[model samples]
Target: MRKAWALLALLGWLCGLAPAIAQVSLPADLTQRELVIGTRVAPPFSMKNAEGAWEGISIDLWRHLAERLGVRYRFEERDTVQALLDAVTTGQVDAAAAALTVTAARRQVMDFTQPFFATGLGVAVGRGGATAWLPVLRTFLSFGFLQGVLTLLGIALLVGTLIWLFERKHHEAYGGPPLRGFIAGAWWSAVAMTQAGAAQDGPRTLPGRILAVIWMVASVVTIAVFIAGITSALTTQRLQGVVRNVGDLRSIRVGAVSGSSTVDFLNAQTVGFESYGLPAQGLRALKAGRIDAFVYDRPLLAWTIQQDFPELEVLPITLDSQNYAIALPQDHPMRVALDVTLLDTLRSEWWTRTRLRYLGNDAAN
Candidate 1:
């Protein structure tokens, strides 16, 4: 009975450790080398702040994973999106943690963890301007212009018919009863198309009414086509009036870090963008009133607002959000090790406190 009890206790302890032991992971290639991490500084996520140098949501998560696996980590800070990608691709770093979108193109180069966040593109318009332009665009593209064109066409047809019919009647029999004050269809069409005030000699008979009907039908179809064309043009230009999305960024001069993610994003979107090499330089230009707006990731933008420029307001919406993932080259043996630890950190309590500390109220609840 004493041996049986001892054996049961040993089995229980082993069962509990099975998962914890299983949870520990080591880099396949690095062996004794510390894990190399590539991170971009963005605020409200990853950055150096009042308390201490910290990382973004994903970075913090990666830290947690390393601690859990009993592996030491050395962070390689990068300033641009391209630099970060180069680190991961060249095996300079075991992984990169940034708010990178899991795009199909990116997948061809690196392996991505399961998407942690789902986000889409958004536009930050000059608050008041977007509202003001909406109505103007609706009017400009609506079917209101069709009536005049149709009226003109209807009248022409009516007049031709009347002229032909009258001649036939005249030749057939009686001295035509002074082609009784009949309205001409062509007259109504001319008036409608030109918005001309009716003259005293205007069409005044039944024939004119028939012309009006024909013009109305033609006008309706014409206007419909015109409106559709206008809408298509607006869609292509994305400019009902002013710039709205990155797609419309061409309409305005956009500011960005010369060699940063913002630049890559614009190039990807095909936005007309100008690069200002340093972040402070771009903000300085904004303060000096040189540029309209700066384009970058939301967390970094928020960090900039808090650490550098406080007066400027960042509208709540992120221009175009993407999921933050730890990336590695396709054949990287550390891929599974990185993602597993990454998942563990995402659920850690320190993760929560770190966010609340930097983001305070701005952090997503």
Candidate 2:
């Protein structure tokens, strides 16, 4: 009775392990078939070279996977990411390779390999457009700048009033009707703050002279801080264009790729934007002053701008996090093997060098 019960337990263990074993197994004819792979032109991930040969990060990954599995495959180029994904869902292609971002909505229709790259959406702006004066005017009208100016004026008024009290009886420079005397004292205080020679004579009384000496030293520090504040405000305004964050998009004319996840995000935020067929089109519109800012994937924007659009720049800010991966048909037979090999490739030193070559020194970050 004990031996019979032990045999049953062993059989149950094998039954539980069947699915795991099946997942890791390759199809007998997979190596003999020529798989159809769909791709789109998303630079640095997948794009055609000058000679019309497809090459990029995602292409290289797919190529590596094909070689490792000993499978033959041919790439079918698609004009739009939506079309490529549609092909995968309808089983027209075995896989879709590009800088495909993984989103919950997309997951409902197709599957994805393990994420190989992670980044976020970034904004881009043109350098040739006329600098908008509204930002500068806003800077002057800003609370921080106005507060600094008002504080300086307040200090000058207090110092002038004190000087008038000390010198009203003796010093001709400050001796007059109350309003006139106050004005003269304030003028002298203003000149003293700038260290510029005052048109009037110095105070004569001991108390008045002592107060003047203290104010002169204090004004040196105060004026330095005041100038620094103005300089900082203007410099920051010059650097931060009309759009600084996603919230800033509401007030500015924004552009993004049509049918992209970025468009979905903008729609969710209720920020109105012009949609372009491609990022390059939006970038050109930005340069032509048709739009105030362009938003898209960070790595693609950086690479495109660095290679062709020297007059354009990507902002240091990110809008949303994204994960880049390979898209496959739902419950693809090769999913397990692809994930296993992709994880191994990503962990290799060759992958490190490949990323650095494409993404520069900040690739690790």
Q: Pick the candidate with the highest lDDT.
A: 2
TM per prediction: 0.57, 0.84
**lDDT for every model?**
0.60, 0.85
TM-score of 2: 0.84
Model 1, residue 30: distance off in Å is: 3.5
Q: Write the per-residue lDDT of candidate 1 for residues 1-365, one digit (tens) a residue.
A: 99999999999999999888557566555657777888776554556656867656766666666666667778888886778887877878877776665666677888877565444432222323333355356445546535544554565555544543543333322123434323332343445434456423333345544554565566567657756765675564343334445554665556787655456577777887667765667767655556656666566565666677764544444455566566787887766766666566557677667767766775553
Worst 10 residues of 2 by lDDT: 126-135
Query: Which digits, one per residue and each the tens of the lDDT, describe model 2 over residues 176-242?
Result: 7999889888888888888888536667889889989999999999999888878887777767765
Error at 100, model 1, angstroms: 4.3
